[model samples]
Target: MILRLTLAAIAFAATLAAPLRAEIAIQEVTSPGGIKAWLVEDHNIPFMALEIRFRGGTSLDQPGKRGAVNLMTATLEEGAGDLDAQGFAAARDGLAARIGFGANSDEVSISVQALSENRAEAMDLLRLALTEPRFDAEAVERVKGQILAGLRADERDPSAIAARLARARSYGDHPYGSAGDGTTDSVTALTRDDVLAAWQGAMARDRVYVAAAGDITADELGLLLDKLLSDLPETGWPLPPPATLNTAGGLFVEPFPGPQSVVLFGHGGIAFDDPDFFAASLLNDILGGGRFSARLMSEVRDKRGLTYGIGTGLSVRDLSAEWMGQFQASNDKVAEAITVVRAEWARMAAGEITETDLATAKTYMTGAYPLRFDGNDAIANILVGMQMLGLPSDYPKTRNDKVNAVTLDDLKRVAARLLKPDDLFFTVVGQPEGLTSSE
Candidate 1:
């Protein structure tokens, strides 16, 4: 059954490729209550996908109330208005609607899908979730237990440890360094009042970005927007201050009971709006973002047999950005792997890429771009993400051209400016030999 469903989804996606490639005409919609959204009308499907994003997600958690926002988001769909958890779930299931909410470091996102015939009822359900979430005490405790269980599991995970350590080292005292799920102790300490405060602070109209796709017209979407979000506060919480990278380059190893080491490495990266962002992206692709074809994969895995897989990419965040990479290797081979990685970094900085490298990277990037617009939900999510990154509306049309326009000189210049082998920091977890923390 899963395989059959997968094939059907793939066929549906293929049907959308042609129309999507022709340019989806996005309409700027304004509700009667003054809320705004981006709408892509497509009557071919009977359902619509709605994506709403609010900036200052978990980062807006009060200093001592670290996990409150995350917990609140989890409980939004658990119950709302006059319904208990099971009651809400049954009502939503009866309508065959889907609604989800989640919080990360930069944003709180809500996703909804409902058929045109049941959209009005679905919107009311969504409105209830947003404006009148019960966050019942029993539900809160249940969700908190689930979160605590995950936190405990992460404590035993080498990859999770390395990731947490990397952010802690990179961002220092900033909220970005803290885990979005909060610590077990912090979560255990949360009260119902804390959850309510987090909900109030994180869900507001001022920071909201909305995008809708599928069977929805502009006028209808505008009215739906007012119905769903007009009750949210005009302004909720102030965003956290920008984080400065505090990393000092060197290997930082945490001893774990494993023969293999998980390594996370990176340096500062270009912002999304920078003119040379696409060049840096292509450079990253050739160096490590191209999966099997990346230089790191070719040199480290294919040639040296040091690790199973290695890859890197740019991370453009709301308040900060970095070029990051990760890989796992046998304890004895980790030193060699790091040596090879640094060599590749230095070689790229020295401009050793060939025309074939540029061509392959461009082809992969451009060809893969269209596949992301395959489904209405995917398109809606991308539209909201583009807004979050401050991208222009024509970005969808011009994105591939920007990728294709990158010249060898552009890659060379960007590589020289952005690649800093000496500044690279490594956070290694496991019993890796011959590696020591500089600090």
Candidate 2:
């Protein structure tokens, strides 16, 4: 009860605080052991959120050991050092701290929040979880059961089926192609050793990036970094190579008996660091930016009533990206819906956007940008993310300018380079009447 109240207070405080301005300074600090982190110091509320991200997340899984890293990450809080799972939870609650561990294709992330009064104890607890995760047999088995259950559920989910099929077809034999959670056979066969190996391969100093917001100083953060991370191994496993994308265009249908078919479509996308990325973003917005006003939603859902929602995005990975989108329509309407999408895709490929379209997208993107920094925790994550993306500290100040700088010609250039209608592929999952597998 006390822990809940403390956390609620932090949330409440964030609500009362003013939105962070772009001119706010981000200080980069390095620890005694040479580990570096970004800091945004706000001493107002006696609370702080610390985020640690280790690059090369589940992509570092060893051959035949898929899901080991994911399972290891889940078990970090199960037990550590002299503490059991129950003990760890009790200790964290006692400190009024919230600590979480997560993993995705590109990184493993650790988040910690604590009040100023109990910060040292919270850090010590986190240090144990990182350095000495027990991964005991009982705990590992329980967590494995949970993962297996989720995998079974994924089999029945239409959206998951479409996404999995798309990944398999688009990125054959790459880490990107396979499920992050191991298949039933692979996960069932996993032993305790694999979990420990995954721990060593994933959680290490070399790949770590850190960020903090609120109630902390650079000097104090330097000491905390060493105290928290110094005991871990210096390096982890090598990151996987870039995905070899199959950019070929086709419509492949997987027959699942459902009233509606879930469609996933895309081809190659621009790189994250590309100079024209801002233009690509604007183009995607005009085409299908998950908003009701975007072209795809306007054409397919609003006018045609084929589906409730249809949206698109750039699925950017470490060294790869794909222009991706998803939508659902009844089995009968799937063909018409897809036809309309392809028409819109081809239309965008021809650099057919208006001045008004460009201006509205720019206004929306630039206007909504500052609201992202709504609270200290969000700002902390943004700081870490900017560093990971190789963005400068002053990026917040310049981002609106960058968004507003793209002229019509630049958008057209990106549209010409990207938006390949011939290369677009669709993975449709359901028993639709007209769609079929094509090459």
Candidate 3:
């Protein structure tokens, strides 16, 4: 309990990181056994954060085991090797290490933090969890119960309803269309073997990426890497085929009891590797990238009072990408809010951006980028994310220049090509007034 409370307190401190703009020197280290990781040396602190990610997360679940990967990830900390749940917690807390595991559609992540003095022991503990997880029946059932409860609760959540419908309408038969948690039926039926399958399918060396920051040398990181992961299978299940998106525009209303409606909207989006991505990013900021100065917020909330908030983003996934947004409003106002959103989309698609809009977006994006590197954990996470995205290691240094080089004309040209006002689809969940399902 004491260590858990200490971790909870550390979370509050982590979030309070000042928006500092510091230069980061990143080095690529390859382990003796050929494992590669990105490292940032910060000797001022006697602590470190390490992040590891594996591609093909829950999407690797076998045909009949939709939620196996997610379930396995949750149960990783429950027990491993000779340790029971309580024993594992006691060992980790004794070393003052905080480790976490998580999964989504595209990737599974492991995060760890430990003081320099106990880094080796902490990593060894993690090694046991990764390579020899007990997956005891009791542990599996407990985590399964928690996931089942969440699935049941999602049945009535308007946001979840809109999200489910949106993905179904967008991705069709692909794995992206369904929930990562699977259905309550599928989860309840999962067995210990299914969880083991998920572990093998998702946690292999072939698809893993690693990064570390603070109080560790490149040589030390390299040696540690091989000790931590050399035993995993070299390969696992094949990745699923790409998702074929339905970009056709229309409104789909799900009837749920509520005075207000939740809506998700978007269409096809640009990919990270696209040459015009920087332009699309600046354009997204000007449109509805969640800032109060965004056009959607200004039109839908400030001027017309149709909704409390509305924003859009470039939602890129392993197999597909889409430009998406969400907002909530009174049932009577949902239609109006969407109308205003459509108008703004059309206006932007028509290349109607002003120089002032471009300047403001560039400044805000550039300034906010540095705030992401406030601590060792944040920097390590960024390093792994950049690797996963296939970005160049020097991206941090060149990123601002790319944003600054985007001229007003660049956004206008990219907006015209990227935004299809007519292709934007809306998924609304609730008794939205004046809204009827599209044919």
Candidate 4:
């Protein structure tokens, strides 16, 4: 009784001590041509970093064109405006500017950085890539060959195969189930028109949300944005509908010719906008997000001595997300490791988190939040991400409060919603002893 009271007191104290504060300040402005953006001006550095995210990403791939978006993104840098692949690379190297573009499962992002004195030229270059990408036939062929080579190489990696199998089994026919990079067949069939159409969707100003940080003012940034994006075709973007999670039953095994076995397990998880997202985040940390302090490390590695290390994460996809817990161990112990994982997952769902466990998870999440903004590039990237996700401008500031708000009850609820062992599509990609095929 006395111990129970002490624990209760501690929990109450933690709730009071580390409250979350979900405040992020954003300054919105309209470009001269009516293009809008969210800004957080900081004139501290002598460089400016800009990140623009398009509403749709890989999920926009049409049927039979599974790698269309991926190929388009890869092709964008091959040539743009008047610069062929080599020429584009030369110009980037000459300016000493770092420019990169990528597409994820849900959004396409372009990151550009240049010296403040050269913002005009940099923006001009960025605008050209965004608008008048050359997409030379030769460059497209080169990128396609490279992608096919990588896919073939990846087929030999057991860990990669395991991850692919996990998502494939979980999502089934969903776009997330397919490879982000196009397959040999898909890439071979891709045409120049398809790339152009994908590009058209990505460059729309309304569908684009630009975030700039570092050495630039709102007014100057606005003008630059106008100068860069004004000439682009005004085709409005229609984001692909969000993906839904499917937690159908049965384990999935991808037999591979390897010594060690890779295992992945989890089911439908929290969405970013779920009010219980903070609770889910805290739960993930206590369970596996913390490599050092998580239950997975302590039980799976320290006590059982099965694997070197294990970690889990809750990924917030373009709209929906999944909680995937993954690890690798010797083939002999694969079954045992899986058993322990399922048990712990059930335990978490049964409200097994103690006050101390909750406090520790919250502390880690809250304290580590600010580390995401340690550099100008990181800040610029996050600011754009926040906008894309429709999070409040003050999200960074108030993040801790939301994390602290997670109660034991909230954790239990989210855990139950997320941890579906029977429904979990476990994929093992190595030759595990005594592991029967679950296909």
Candidate 5:
């Protein structure tokens, strides 16, 4: 009776403390020129931040024009309107504003941060960067050299080699198989014309997503957005179709001169729109997604002491989605590590989750979920991403409930469908002792 009373007192204290945390406010804005954006205002700070993303990412690269979009993003800041690279730098410093641009596998992003006192001038500078970019050749080459250096450096890292080989084996002949940062061969061959054409083809108003946070009113943001997106052409290029998932059986080894082997293996998984997505996320949490209280950690760390860490998740992109799991262990334990992974895969495939396991997973997933909305920038970013993925406005409010609703039967079904040990693609990098393709 005393222990029950103590537990009740602790629960009461937690309930009382929960209300002290602030909730994020989400507001949608549509510009006069029809550009829509999500906004979150935080008056606590004296500065504002704007983040915008476009749809045509690395997946949209044409055959021989690889890395063109990345080059465009890099060069856009070099010159714009009447300002060359040096002139633009002077202008930015004059207003004490910061701006940057980059592209990823699924989207290209532009971000700016400025003081509230100089919001208008800062925004105009952003407008010039966005709508009047010059795409200078020298700037393009400079960025290309930086990328080449990274590619060279990555070759020496066993983890990087393992990841690259895994994708190549999993998505053969598909654009999604290629690296977001183009290969050394492809990037070295790119020209100025290719960069310009890719910019004109990919960066369009129709494919844009905007997000802002800080000391700005709705009216100010509306006007700023109009000025920034005004020069975009009316139509955009059609987005390429989604990537295909290849589950054919294959294993490859990239023998790196290292003592450890970085092993990566998984198969096709569900899309974001799948009703089973929330359930699948919870299932992954139980298996290997969580840092603690996961099957992989228990088996690989606590029992065998093989590796220090393991991870699993859905690798979601605009063109494709896949279930991926990874681990690293010493060369001597590589075979043992692979065996544990396969056993866990088979165990999940056979639907063996216990009541205790399910309950623990649910608590980990739901209890920590609210932390994602702790700040204005995080909230704005989440809203913008959800809009791009076609998720509902109420997604954040209902996400935990959906996760809580996933059952043992749901996990069984998703696991059986997604976990394909027979068809998995394996890539092990480093000089693992006594390791073979068969293992």
Candidate 6:
């Protein structure tokens, strides 16, 4: 099955590379009720993929109710209207439709895929789930239990511990600092009323972004949007204030019994719409943005075998932005790895980059763009994300041009302005030799 999926993905990528890149068009559609969406019409396939994102997400959780939004979103499809949890699942399965609801710190997303023949039925089911989710006590407890179990598991996960601690230190008391899944105690304390209120506070029309692809016309998509989402509240809870990173350059060490220590290090990042974003992106690509040729991988892993891998990239969120990286190494070597990382960070901050690095990063980024638009589902998801990021519809066509336009001078300028070795904070989880907490 894995091999089959791999081949299917390759074929889909090939299709996108051939004619789709040149011919794909995005149309803006506004429903009669004034809700807007981006549509990509493709009649070649009889199925449509619709993606919707609500911006407030778990960040809108009421004070002392950290996990309410997450728990509420998870229970959305569990039961709604006349359908109980089991009945809802049965009805959805009966039509061979796919529907999913999920939430993270920044957004709550819903994705649905349905054949044109059964599209109406599928939409109706989705409408029921969104507009009239039945937060029955039984279903609520079941889902809450699952979330609690996950939280328990996360407590023992070294990576999860590092991430939670890093965010907590970075954002302080802001909502972004808290775990989206909440703590075991928070989930346990949740009541059904809290769940219902979370639905009201997080899911609403005003904060929604929509994208649709395949077997759907603008008019049809507009109508579907109204039918599925018109009943939601006009607005959700007020948005959270932007969060600022509070941790200055330093190391925070949490002692744990393990041979390997996980390190999370980062500093502030640029916004998505910044003019120098492309340059910053190329800089990151050359530094540690997933490619094996990245400086971090080549220097840390290939040259010295400090760890199996290492990477860094920009994380742009609605309320905050960060440039972060992570890697794990044996306790005996973690201090050396940190020394190497600090040297690289200082080097990059001093604008030590070459024309060769710029050209290579740009070529790889531009060449890999089309591979991301492999199918209707992928495209739809990308469209909604673009909308959320305030990108113009023509971004897809001009994105590579933007990447190609970055000059060696541009990269150095942005690197000097953006990279902050002095502001980088490290959160290390596990006992390591010769390292002390800067805190």
What's the residue-level lDDT of 70 in candidate 5? 79
Residue 117 lDDT, candidate 5, scale 0-100: 70
Report how far residue 370 has shifted in candidate 4, in Å. 1.0
Candidate order, TM-score descending = 2, 3, 1, 6, 4, 5
The clash count of every prediction, one per candidate, is: 0, 0, 0, 9, 0, 0
Per-residue error (Å), model 1, residue 71: 0.6
10 residues in a row with least lDDT, candidate 3: 10-19
Top TM-score: which candidate number? 2
Per-prediction TM-score:
0.96, 0.98, 0.97, 0.90, 0.90, 0.96
Tens-digit lDDT track for model 5 on 273-331?
A: 98989878887888889666789888988899999988889888777888888888898
Q: Which clashing pairs does model 1 show?
A: none
Question: Candidate 2: where is the Cα deviation over 4 Å?
Answer: 18-20
Candidate 5, lDDT over the whole model: 0.77
**Tens digits of per-residue lDDT for model 2 on 1-439?**
9676977788569746836466667898998889899998988788889999999888888989999999999999998999999999999999999999999988999988888889999999999999988888999999999999999999999998898899899998888897878788889988999999999999888899999988999999999999999989998899888889998898999999979999999999988799999999999999999679999999999999999999999988886899999999999999999899999998988989989989999998998888888777888888988888999888999999999999999988789899988888999999888878995
Cα lDDT of model 6 by residue, 1-439, tens digit: 4433543454355346434452369999999989999998888767778999999889998988889999999999888999999999988877767899999988999998776777899999999999999999999999999999899998899999999999899998999898888988888999999999999989888899999988889999999999999999998999999997784799999988899999999989989989999999999999999899998898899999999999998999998889999999999989999888888988987988999998889888988887777678888999999999999998898899899998998988898999888888999999989999999
Candidate achieving higher lDDT, 1 or 3? 3
lDDT of 1 at 170: 93
- Per-residue error for 64 in candidate 5, Å, reads 0.3
Ten residues in sequence with the least summed lDDT for candidate 6 = 2-11
Candidate 1, overall lDDT?
0.89
Q: Between the candidate structures 2 and 4, which one is better when assessed by TM-score? A: 2
